[model samples]
Target: MMLAGYLVAVLAGLFAVVAIYAMLSSLPNAPDYFSVVGVSPIAALLVPPLGMFIYFLTIVLTGMQTLVFALIAEFFSLRNALLHMMFGAIAAVAGFALIWPGASENPERWADMGIIGTAGVVAGLVYWLIAGRDAGFRRPLFERA
Candidate 1:
């Protein structure tokens, strides 16, 4: 269930990135969309969501392992938003690094790295917003609570 929520949030972020890219690519001065986007928009629209599922699954598994280790050492604590932000930063760097080698081959594609990194950060933030809150965190429906 949590994964579903995270998936929705990430997909929404990805859509926003694609929409922005599409708009920017249409500008007369903009570089070719294929070079900037690194893939056809059709593929761009389809690939990340699928890739993210795998990527996020890896994150979850690694987090679980870390949690288990922390628990064994009595160092575990409730989830923190700052920690989520840290994860977001890490994801952004990792995403950018993964594409850097290929992007370096073409000067035009270098600009796309920024766009891809931005998208990664957005996806991370969306995931954090959807799922990073601690169990004790709550919001009241009325202001007078």
Candidate 2:
């Protein structure tokens, strides 16, 4: 169930980003959802689900980063949101860099950064909704206070 929820959230985020990108670019508004589903298996054969895994890991790590900042840096929730946004932007750029190296010089790269960052923000919001607005880290491996 947890995995299913995460998958759905990630896919939804991806589709939302694609849609927004299309709209902003004044390109065709049609989103080929079937293409994504159809290509997953072939793409996985090349990188073994690397894209999906990276997105999931990025979301989880961003949440952990947010928690760390909130706890150690005494950051407010707003600051936490900013931190997550920054992380998302960096992650998206870095992911693109790893995949396409010098493609950063392209104008479209900036647009992609915007889309991916927005997706990250959306994912974070969804996660917070599911996990709770005031959720905090807990340590089951350690003795109770």
Candidate 3:
């Protein structure tokens, strides 16, 4: 269970990294900041091979996060966090590929991306919901699940 938790955090972190990198790469000027009904500071680090590092880190961090949650959910009884993380990551990666930025303008692509995104979110939520409660995290779903 301890190992599983570590894996989940690592994987979740990795996912964040990739998502951030993709988002940043798609934008211009390494954007100092951006907003979506609210303001957020943009990352400006200049890590070489930033894309590749992000990709790897995302895989690791997200895995760790997922594992940690899954283990907690199973009362430190389950030992399959790696499997859960792998499958969930697969779903997310597929969503990312299908709903890439270019698809924003293409109706078909946009629709596909939406579907994929929804799938990824649902899968992730399911894992987290179960894990959180099992682990006694007891926090309300931040975004209504």
Q: Model 3: per-residue lDDT, tens digit, 3-57?
A: 4434354345344434554464456664333222011112323544664564455
Tens-place lDDT per residue, model 1, 53-138, is: 64565355334433332242223333565555445445544555564657667777666656655665565556556655522234
Question: What's the CA RMSD for each of the models?
Answer: 6.9, 8.0, 13.8
Most TM-score-accurate candidate: 1
For model 3 the local lDDT of residue 7 reads: 39
lDDT of 2 by residue, 92-141 (tens): 44554555566668775665566666775665445444432333444246
> Residue pairs in steric clash, candidate 2?
none
**Whole-model Cα lDDT per candidate?**
0.52, 0.50, 0.45
User: How many collisions per candidate?
Assistant: 0, 0, 29
Range of the 10 consecutive residues with the lowest summed lDDT in candidate 2? 70-79
Of 2 and 3, the candidate ahead on TM-score is 2
TM-score of each predicted structure versus truth: 0.51, 0.46, 0.28
Indicate which candidate wins on lDDT: 1
